[model samples]
Target: MSAYAIARLRPFAEPGEDVFTYIERFQSTLDPFGGRFLVHGGQLDEVEGSWPGYAVVIVFPDRATAHAWYQSDAYQELVPLRTRTIEGEVIIVDGVAEDYDPAGMAVRMRAASAGAV
Candidate 1:
């Protein structure tokens, strides 16, 4: 299945030059893992809720590729810079397949909850 890197970040501290430095070299870390940005932080429409931060989404070929990119040494080295600048959450998530069925899962869940499965 495809995977994604989703992060919601906003400046919590006085951002320094290191944040720019991290951004400058961020792409290099993703190249080896075949990760591409689906969305990079920008001005939000905010039609629903009060969102004062940026939302970033990156797509990878698979969950393993996504995890590998996040865990790579090159990416690891840049972590401190962002940590010092932004405060937010980042997560890797698996994407559903094309033929995914919600009804099937509901049925299965109901069975499991009833101790039938």
Candidate 2:
């Protein structure tokens, strides 16, 4: 199953040269790690709580690949640039398979725990 790395960014100030530089360099870093951008920038409609600023979502082949891309030196090098410009949260989550069942997770967890006991 595929995984995703999602970033919700709120910029503290207008983008500058360093921000532009990070954006340009960051694009190339994804391909090497089987990662691709799913959502870069688009109109956000907040149905609930207030959310300000931009959001980005990147898809990877799996959770491991997503973690690798994040921990890679190339991506880490650009972190400071982004941090200097914005405040945001990033998270990696597993994608559901085609046969996904919401209730099955609890059953599976119970079975695994019972086995461990």
The Cα local distance difference test for each model comes to 0.90, 0.91
Clashing pairs in 1: none
Which residue ranges in model 1 land beyond 4 Å of their true spot?
11-14, 47-50
Which regions of candidate 2 deviate over 4 angstroms?
103-117
Please provide, for model 1 over 1-117, each residue's C-alpha lDDT reduced to its tens digit, 9 standing for 90 to 100: 899999989755566798899889999999999898989987789899787788999999999999989999999999998887788899999999999999999999998999963
TM-score of each: 0.85, 0.85
TM-score of 2: 0.85
Candidate 2 lDDT by residue in tens digits, 11-56: 4667898789999999888989889889997899899998898889
